[model samples]
Target: MKYILDFDIAAVCISCITLFLFYERKQRRFGPGESYGRIAWTVLLSSVFSAASSYFANALPGTSGAATMATVTLFYLFHNSIAFFAAVYILNYGGLLPVKKTMRVLLALPWAIAIAAVASNPITRLISYVDSANVYRRGPLFFILYLLSTLYFLIIIAALFFKRSHYRKSHQRAFLAAALAPVLAALIQGFNRGLMLECFGASVSALLALITIQNASELMDGQSGLYHRESFIEFLAGAFKKKEPFTVLIAHSPELADLQGSLEMQNYRALVAQVSKWMFQASGAGAAPSWVGTGVFGLLFSRRLKSNPVGDLALKILDLADASWSVGSLHVKVPFKVTILQCPEDAADISDVVDCIDQIAEVARHSAHKKIYTKFDFSVGKHKRSSAVAAALERCLERESPELFYQPVYSIARSKPFALEVLLGLSLVNNEQAFQSEVLSTAEKMGVSRQLTELTLKKAFEWHAANKQELAGIDQLQLRLVSSMCLDLDWPRTVLKTAADARMDLSKVCFEITETTVSRFGNDLAMNMELLTGKGVSFALDDFGSGYTNLVKLAPMPFSIIKFDKKIIQPGLQSNKGRQLLEGMVDIFKRRECAVAAEGVETEAQAGMLALMNFDHLQGYLFGKPMSGQRIVEALKNG
Candidate 1:
């Protein structure tokens, strides 16, 4: 070989060795892919075949020249064929190759034919011939086959190159470049014999070495340094494989996108990255950390610890990362919440970890200010108390444990009761105190908020049905329908059907919806309300001005009654601005042929004020606290 060629070959060999060493190191630090394993086997196989072919070529002198040439040709063919398969395997594993079976078969056919041809050709005359000088000289067919194989390899590498280019991560590109270098070198060598191809191989090996070094550095830094979802999943798998009793801590920066658009995005991202680093460090003890999503980071541990890992990590993150970073000087701080999943206790597989993290992220997204961390509790009891309140609410439904109390709405002009607004009361079975908001919120969560609303409506309807003769003079009864239940298709249909079967006068029953429910459900409220109102049932917007009420929602909905929320009426009955807005709303409702009821009239002054403001009805503790049917009946009779 010429000096340059010798140097080139030495460089190629060195590159291959470097790549092999790097591959070994990476396999140790991370895990190996099936394709990596196959490629390694192929490299070993190709090297053996190349050596055998070179030896046979050198040996084909004078005696059995044809057979020696043929053996050498066969070895070359087998080596190249296996190389093609290795390329195919790598591309397929990387999801770069077409997955269609037909496409794969078509791609493999050429290499398969070449292998078959070489195995069948006993004389090897197709690729080489023994000249009278007893030297094995290449035939035209040999060059053609070489060109064909080289072109095939080039096509495969090109496909992978294009595929890798689409990926955003720098590490992924480096990995792909490392994997493709050998194939590119082999292709260059097939077309020309000189130092160029060998130089290419050396350069490729150097790049592969860089990839290994960079990844190792990242691993040492406790960062998987893989910026792709695939890498995170692989890391998770390894964590499970090692049977590490680790907790997966998921932190979501809900305002990430918003921050990105703001002036503070750069600083915000830096803060988040810093927090992520601290969180990983705080997790400590064989914790394999990765950024699983744009806003999510995951940590895998080898053993479960007694300490509250999530809380500790969260505090560290809050300390290191500016938890108070604001966007655009708006003083709006993004909420950061963390969820911890301990191995075996939280999940047994990577998928379970992912799911738990997602669930926690959802919870975190809804968390109030400063409520930053939560743990995945599998105990049916714990979740029911916290996240799964709705799930356990079925027990409450069976007992009909919720009671209905009525507050009378009195007509201001006649000084007579016009309607009674029904409210839900949940007295716990064990005399345990529970938040009314929680009971209702749990019902909403459990998807039984509608059921509870319907139950309240049913009890009120039953009371009215039995007392219709005694209260025959009364024109209407206002029953509070949770705005959530009004949005519930099933519950509304069932309630309406039950009301229809009872032959209850629809005009006498006014369905009231709370302001909070209206804001939460929004346009979702319209459909259920329309269904009931179309049946002659009057609808009331209860607790107006307390939620995101606007003239727009009221204008479109068939609200025959508007009940001012207590917040709007209390401490504001005397305020001119408050009264003006209320009066304006009442005026708007009155123009639409609606009656307005003022709620929370604690004093005769408040009532007198409301009566003068043209409120059609008034209600409050001043009139009566929500009382039992008997008390309401007595109050009506006495008045």
Candidate 2:
């Protein structure tokens, strides 16, 4: 039987090219780098051995039978080994590989049996033997090698079938083609041994594995040189499904947002690469970190109880972030907030983990300095609930059915409610203030703050219009407005038009802006306030003393009222210096002709003290909790 060396030579060349490509590729440690590595090398070896066996079998005419036998044996050995390695790779890729040593050994038993049968072939003369002319010939048990290859392909197919949901359609096709290529080539060679197609099939499988699994472009972030978000999610879901315990350290850099386009491209890449490399090393998990968002990077490492305390890890990460990074001529300090989440311990699944990451990253973006967010600060359940409330609120806003409640701001001197503060109510969230914070933050993130403001304004004006008699005694109807609305020059016109459409009295309306908003957009907000103030709309500085508020900046603003946050009022009730500070602020506002209102006045003592301090409007539970418009009308009528 004559053997063709042309196909063998071509297969060897293709295999070499595949192996070279795999070697030169940028490999991610967390991916199937090692598995694809073995496949590449093994396929190259298989092709080389197959070509050598063909050479020696026909070329070593009537001289050295030992060389022919050895080469033939090696060709079959590596050919079978290719199938074995590919099967292991697929199993691991599907996250079906057993973690236990015993189970892993059981999984490898068939490949081990194939190795044993091939090794004992020279004496037993069962697989391949050198004939009298030094030509390779199939033995009695030669089909055993084919059977083993078929068995591995079957296992791969079964895994692909069962784990179909785990991978995308493109990946499923790649896996299927990779597994089927070798089997189809084997079938072709099995029917005609002279065809020499097995090595070609091995080359095809190597190319597929290299392109699809080993060095896939989707697995990496171009800027950070880390795994991308989709890859991270897929890896995390696999871990969750396997029930493997791990800890994730998610760090977000707020400075990255500011430094985005300022630095040169090379410097930006270098900075991101430096941070990613440092994070991967700090994780100690031998896996690559991932770029989850613009400034968010997530490090998922194996959980070690004794060695790796999540708190200490978070501190170490924060400390590393504190170091100054030199990017070209720029010496920048990128602040990072690290949040720690434990698998199965902190989160129920991958969805919860993702929600927790978003919530913490959002908090980190707003925070000023390096901080660590632990499970205690923001738990999975709390994040999920906040997410649920945000989702529900979004739906409500879209439907234009946002629920609003009114809380009375009682007058200390007149002993009557002087103002009604409108609060956005969410039955999903228990606390009124928390609900407002969530709505504002959610609206900002969802890019619907303007929609929320417009809806709330329209609703408040309509309520006031319908119940004009009930609100006649109230001096002001206060509405909380987000700062983004003030950035628009036409925001005042929009507010006035909404009030006009509802036929509500604009003089009876007061818009409240948080101290944080005033500090951020003081110039724009002041202009908007002045515009609205000229049209008989009052502006109140809400949540004063709870954020970064500058007194000098506040003086230039046209706010008619100052509502102190509970953080200030509660502390004022506890200490003498706090009371002095409160009195001084009140006196300053009084001189400015701004009516100072004390919020969160829950008890008689708080109300009495605030009243004594000459707080014109006293608010909180002492006056009345936030109630619906109808309930507010009833409360006012009953009083």
Candidate 3:
């Protein structure tokens, strides 16, 4: 009865190592990880018991009878449970089981029966027992338990096969090997009884499962420790396919860019991780938290154990966000814009849900205040319009057919055109109502703002080259830079190269930056402006008085022109106080030797008022509306 313990010893060592690796990963366990964790624990314990059982059973007549029986009973208890736990893991991993207590209890029935039989084996001597000689022997009911265990393995294999389409190829292979390796070895040992391969099979299965299924880096953000965007989207898609009721809450941080710019890279990552942990804890059971995009986090509560209290969770999150967060010697406030959407009610399919999330995230990025949005508050029309524009933008950029319009900036001093502003002639609807801001913002989201800028510059410079003889009176060609391009460090050199390629005079180019973009600019923007300004290009602070205008802050940036926002000029024409303010602003700019332009001037009185205020330039409907390059050139020729 002396059995070779080579396989049992090897299994014990391998399972111990596998279990150590599983726990050492320290991943935030999603549903599949939790189930696989159970399997890891079960397989490791089963291997230990299997090795001990072999030692006692091999000693035969020399081993203590009671001691042998106890070890043998524990071995059967743990060894027979591996298949049952594996089956449960498979069900959970495949999303076959709902997150319900009742369903879980039903799923545990077979394992419960196996545990009961094994626990009572000493008295009944049904499944396994130790003889008087202290040798382990199978009882009459041994095959019954073995058959039940084999049934569980069969179910795992079948589930893996039938659900193959639902999983990636790698997942299918890993799950199949996990189910088949153990059962095949067990079946061989069940017939021969000499080869102790059962535990070895379990160890192999555990190792395979842990390596493939428990690798979190594939599905999670390395910094935030939350599921990545694709993983989160796939989870939602699966839940939707199952018709599982669910709600998603998106938390977008408007200050994320500011935080990134302020903090060191490591410190910034720590801040993101802290925020991610807080969001994850607030989500209820069966909830999955994901880092959907930069500055955007999504919490999906699917098949939740209880009702989805997403609204309260969002409110609580915002309340917490109101306070300052302490991260690595920095006390910073991370503002959030929260929105909740329910499946089948708010979104019809995965595409709809993705589109809605994208558009909402975009809105949240620019929103100034913290607020909450319910399903009813989400604008379906806005989402549809933005989505359409985004799609059209992609096509328009690829085809290089986006329209460009030119508007003249009138010189009040000389009573003629001083500059021609290049504008993107983009519209959201067929009516051709201007949506250049929306188009530019969408281009930023799509990572094509730089492309749009390049295309506009190429077309404008080429048109100017083609119509060099048309009036020959334009002093400057003004091109507005979007926020994304302004933040890019390479923009200065790249734009100069673009201009050089077009053979355009650098002295005649004026780059317009909006007032809001000024606050977000860092040293890189200043350096970029210096580089371009060194090349004889002028810079204009566009849309002044529209936002928090700090003249002292603008003093160091080397802006040569300040354009008054329409909101500023309209009021200046109506009231004495407004006129005084306008005149004072104009006088300050003039003293600094910076030319001032009044934008949005439309009437004779408004034009006269701006002229009296000592505005050097005027641009509005009163001067000229945005028209085609050809028409604009023809008008300049006729005038």
On lDDT, the leading prediction is 2
Single out the weakest 10-residue window by summed lDDT for candidate 3. 24-33
Encode model 1's per-residue lDDT on 227-342: one tens digit a residue: 34555566676556554466566666666535556546556556555555555556653454566765566665445455555656666655534555433344445555566666
lDDT of 2 by residue, 392-490 (tens): 777788689888989999988899898898888665645533467777777887788888889999998998889988778988889888878877878
Which candidate tops TM-score? 2
Whole-model lDDT, model 1: 0.61
Query: Where in model 2 is the C-alpha error above 4 Å?
Result: 1-29, 32-193, 216-241, 246-285, 289-398, 401-403, 413-418, 425-434, 463-475, 519-527, 547-558, 628-639
By lDDT rank, best first, the candidates go 2, 3, 1
TM for candidate 3 is 0.52
At residue 179, what lDDT does model 2 achieve? Answer: 82
The model with the greater TM-score, 2 or 3, is: 2
Model 3 error, position 376 (Å)? 6.2
TM-score list, all predictions? 0.45, 0.66, 0.52
